[model samples]
Target: LSYVDGFDITRHWGNKSSYHSANDFDMTRHWGHLSPYHPADSFGIQDIGIPSNCEVSQVHILHRHGQRFPTTAFNDGGNTQRFAYKESARWWASGFFDNSDGGSSSTSYDLLVIPEDGTENNTLVAHDSCRNSDDDIIRCFEDTTQGVFTNNYLKTVLARLSNYLDPKFNLTIMDVYAMQTICPYEVAYQGSSDFCRLFTEQEWIDFDYALSLRFYGNRSFGNPTGRVHDIGYVQELLARLQNQYIYVGNISVNSTLDNNPTTFPLGQPFYLDMTHDNIMVGVLSALGLNYFKGSPTGLPYNITHAPNPPENF
Candidate 1:
């Protein structure tokens, strides 16, 4: 990463060979929302623990395949089934969740499948309100960053990784990315992948950087309607938090479920709802949490010593 990507942390963890465990090289850790459950960096407040005077009260887990970051979750490889099995409690997950062995019959009521017929409003799956048009900030970020990424990041990655390949076979940018990406998947399903060893930890982090640019911009707050896409669940969450049914509607909140106590029970000690990882990120913006937010204006993050953000906001 010193000459290849110039990552800041590369100086510290650059070529150190001691940090060699499967845990150290796990690419799933850097997949943003798709990443497995991990602790946020200890930057804000330096301590996130509640006051000692306070006692544990309510718990709401907005799960994807398993536990995610604060107020969000996602689905991943071998870890996917591990979560479902460990929960052992109630399972309120998406019906579409299909592992290698399918789902357990014990958690039948947990299934929530939304048809793409465009009628189900209270769903995090492919929100149409936020994605109805393409001329929004998503397109802007893509148009602005994709080329820069290709010319700068992708080119460097391809050149460095190509050295390991046979000279008879040429490795394109797509080939490099695909090979790097398949690590997480192969590990999740098949248990281990040889591709996992092809890149350094910094390379994985940089590839994760490229992915962060795409997902954070296209699916979450970087887009114009980022929060709006996942507001339904947010509202439902508030209702549960306050032990009251939501009164306002016409957006994503499906009144039928939120209104019904059977579907949306109140005063529960714990709550779990599984959805898409992309929406999990959008939920973060909807809740207005600044933990992962690098910039308020939602401009793409630049990995430079001094980032020259555009003026005239």
Candidate 2:
């Protein structure tokens, strides 16, 4: 985390986190779920367009819901929901479809119908996405981060703030991270916040990596229940692609909905389903997209390197 040198005046920025394994990127566009919609081109696929000889057929499009407030206070509903109804099609949202976009649509149906990427897990998840128990991966990640993984960064940050912070306030390392996270939210709420310039660019990158590390263990493939979250969606996709009524009991997949032809149509031009960002990660894991699983720069969640950041980083 370097300084802005206090010389440049045009929106000079110092940061302690970056969004993704991006290049000389200036803005923080890699803040994981909180980040703006960026391409998943990290896969390094050469040809993205459809082949000249092959025409577009059925397309299964899965994406996260629009920008919403943090799930802490309110549900993640946003103004972007209305736009989904701009097209003429039957609308179906997942189970946790609490946010209603005026219940308006271009289709004959008065309200959005059917189940989609909403919180539609009506059944009980065996693992239930990892509880906050001490044995959970989250606890493991937290323990590692606060210990050998990043003791140096935390200690250094704590040391750096010893003189400036008021003696009345005792801020711990977690509090320091909370301070770092506030910058993005503050910028989003208003136009800006001085908090954005608190840290240098390298610090921003380190924080982002820390976050990625946490997500890797708790939300993504590192957790036992990670891929299972999207297993239902993958089964539905396969049913549509194969044009069959394949029914299998799953942790989250609704059998009644899948069996009904009216609800689960096999043939369609394109299907759009909205889901949580974590579920999409599960989908990637379910599909075995190894491209997102690693990188030459020692990314893809090789946590073995975390304890030795100086050597690998």
Candidate 3:
């Protein structure tokens, strides 16, 4: 009878050109038969089970970050520069010469002189040259580092949760705790690149320096070793919870008319954890509740099936 709801805040930030409100995104109107809330005569538990009596013991909200400026090849350009550099290096090693460098016919140089009108034309050549020769990619790195999507969206959502809790619950103010992934720099910078490759000595040093700059703004460093610390944080919290103690005392009084009049007391406490989408999906999938057709809420008034409970629970 516990009142539990699963929500993905990022899902609410759907394509801006489309629906505007939560009601508008209710699937029934968007995709016809594919909608979870179709027929208009059906009802889901979320709609009909209002005014539930169960007090919320805990809430675990796992959601994705807000809309991101598309990071795939469709948006922030591709790995064309990296691939081109590899190709150029291979061609040069195989005796391809750039005649631009003056030298004896027998004296060979390893450089690919891309033509002005080819695929590697003026624009692409200039971009590659800047990214390779002068580390102009730093500007791209900085642009993403200072971007606003994640931080702003997270703050807004947290504020909304705080406001909702203040009026809806009677628990002590300090009972609620919120936590998020700590090493966002790693998440943001790694992009789609594979990080398993062994780095050269200079490459390793450069990576360390870049990581320092990312975490500490090139001044003071904090936990530059990546996301391993989050595991320790989680373990520490769990240990504290396991070690917590509670006590209760009984009082007795005598009544003149009634011989057996007594009361029993009970005590309970709970914990809540805030996390992200992948963790939720992983858990749901493990519990065999990850399957879905259209929307999460099923059909409209009485049409589609309801969301299934997690099998493990």
Candidate 4:
């Protein structure tokens, strides 16, 4: 058996026209960037050489998600001051403002009355311990919208892929695997808070619109802040993948037709694991080669190699 990762046909086309202005973005700029589309020869299939004896029984394509919205929050001066002094002080000290004196204590923003030791602090504090200022929360909502857009874009890409595969193979019953941890990490203001409320209807609408823009336009929200950890999850995934391969390999080798062998003849049969750049790096770490290096050409692991042979048959 032989393996050839499905070629990425869209890389040379650049982002959709709706995503950029004519002057700013150019598809040709990426013409020779060493993507799957940039074959050394005239024929695109020349890049992926198929072995003569081996058959393409299966193809596992693990691809990165499409371009994402910026995840970074734009904290202007007003937002900074509002969070640092006002929200922080109110949350930390539990003190009320002077205006809530006459209103019902439960719904009021008054912070003067401290709850007794046994008294439930639920009313005074937020439901989620992680809270950010109004602006920050709005920004986060916007960022989340981008994630939603990414999902939709992925669906579109998959639909196109399905169409492309329909003629060549029976893709109707192909199994698709998506990572469960495929979500944007939340951006919290301080370590103490976990959730922020988008109080106004306009704020909610704006967030949805921002997400739409990110999906349709390919504008990034910027990078996320705060700690993002994936160590345990990654380890679990790796362990499962290894166990699955081991079991499958053992079954194949022990079958009545096969002789005992040290290694699986064509290597363990498996499909691609769809994941993010972060997860790819995590998997690579266990496989060694942890040092930082430049991008991947046609070569794997940043190592240079001769181009694959052209199709002889």
Task: Summarize candidate 3's per-residue lDDT along 41-143 as a digit string, tens digits.
Answer: 4334365443578665433222223212222243333322333333433433343244433233224422323342222312112222122322344334322
User: What lDDT does each candidate get?
Assistant: 0.55, 0.51, 0.26, 0.27
Using TM-score as the measure, what is the rank order of every candidate, best first? 2, 1, 4, 3
lDDT tens digits by residue: candidate 4, 1-313: 1111432323322332111123433221121111112222343445567778987654433333232222223521122221222233333223232433333333533222322222222111211112331345445643454444434333433455477465766432112111111111111121110111111222222223333333221111121311111232233334334443223212102222122232222233433333333333333333334232212321121111111331110
Write one digit per residue (lDDT tens) for candidate 1, span 1-313: 0011111222222333121344445445654443545554544456567887897789877655532322222322223232442242333222333332334544544434444344566455536444463565546764455445534556667787878779888888777777766665554444445676666666666666666666556656566665666777777888888899765565677777677777777887766565566677778778877655566765444442113332111
* TM-score winner, 2 or 3: 2
Model 2 lDDT tens row, 1-313: 0112221233333443322223444545434455444454443558668877999888777655332234422323232443332222233432223324524433322232443333554222212332332365545743454344344455567667766978887878766676666765544444355665666556665666666655555444555555555676788788889887657646666677677777676777667665555566667777876554544332343342333332111
lDDT of 2: 0.51
> Which candidate number maximizes TM-score?
2
Decoy 2 TM-score against native: 0.67
TM-score of 3: 0.20
How many residue pairs in model 3 have overlapping backbones?
A: 12
Q: Give the root-mean-square deviation of each candidate in angstroms.
A: 8.9, 8.2, 31.9, 25.7
- Candidate 4 at residue 10, lDDT? 35
